[model samples]
Target: MRLIELYKSVQGESSFTGVPCIFVRFAGCNLRCSWCDSTYTFQGGKPFTEDEVVAQIEALQPCPLIEFTGGEPMLHERELLPLMQRLLRDESRRYTLMMETSGERPLGEVPTEVHKIVDVKCPGSGSAFGSFRMSNLDALTSRDEVKFVLRDRRDYEFARDFIREHLQGKVAEGTLGGILLSPAFHQSPSPLRTADNMELDARDLVSWMLEDGLPARLSLQIHKFVWEPQKKGV
Candidate 1:
């Protein structure tokens, strides 16, 4: 598979936040979001065979949680599927798998055992906005998650309406996995973090969610706070 870096880090988003996990970051992406933090993943990565990828993952060790993320991991589902199968079916250890995708690809083939964290780009995400494959909503399982990255009240409202329309009663009915809304961050590749890295404050987001009673979780990329905001491999 075409690869970026494979490293162990604490999961910084989704319901699995703060958990120690191994991140398999694949290279290349189709969409360019306004606030994308991983633009480095769009191109230029070392090549690795499936076996090489497995060896690196095993080196991380002890952390049973593994996340397949990328510029977009779904782009390599052809190879990823078998890798996930091997890890899940390993005789020495069992790994909990996770994937983060842009929700623009067909997910019908993804295994049910993998925790899929799909993103529905808010209008503020610019070019990637409305690029989500609406059909993927039907593919989400109870172990899956739908994420919305917001930049302002307008984006928050868009998320609210989306859940109201397509994700109707999923949260209340417990038929689907968790829904999440996160503030877009101004990413800078620097060691000294800036004062305004976050475009939308988490407090304001929480207020909006409470007032509207949106049945979703408030997701903060905790790694940004724990480490430098633009630092890679975390």
Candidate 2:
């Protein structure tokens, strides 16, 4: 597998926020989101085999939660399947395997045991609007989560309508996991303040959700607040 960096850190978003987890960030992404913070993962990274990756995770004492994140983890489905299988089969310790994937790829190859957190990119991401795989929605179970990173009010409304059209019923029925709405974080300071360059304020997002009665939880990048926002290998 082409590995970027593997380290232990508190999960920064989703329902798992604030929990200590080991992250396996793979290198390379298919989408070029303007607000992307991990651009370094798009290029060079050290390669490691499945066994080597597992060994490194095993070294993290008392760590039970594992997240397979990426430039886009679903890009390496072939390599990830066996690694996830090995982790699931291990009897010495129980591990919770979670995958963070852009909803652009087919998710059929991933095991049901692994919890998936799929990102549905908004227009503010600079990617083509409505590029997400609608089929991925059917693939989700109650254990999985859908995340939307809002860059502005438009992005928030887009996400809101998407949920109303696709996710609200399922979420209410207990078939789909909860929805997560997060404000996009700015990677660097800008001289001029603009919606495109500035980080979306979480308070504003929260107020909008409350006013609209959106059925989603507010997610913030807790790790960014704890460490330098641009730091890699967190």
Superposed model 1: Cα runs more than 4 Å off: 189-195
Error of 2 at 221 (Å): 0.7
Writing each residue's lDDT as its tens digit, candidate 2 over 131-153 gives 69999888899989999988899
lDDT of 1: 0.89
Cα lDDT for residue 30, candidate 2: 88
Tell me the alpha-carbon RMSD of every candidate. 1.5, 2.7
Candidate 1, 138-178: lDDT as tens digits: 89888988999989999999999999987858777777889
User: In order, what lDDT does every prediction score?
Assistant: 0.89, 0.87
* Top TM-score model: 1
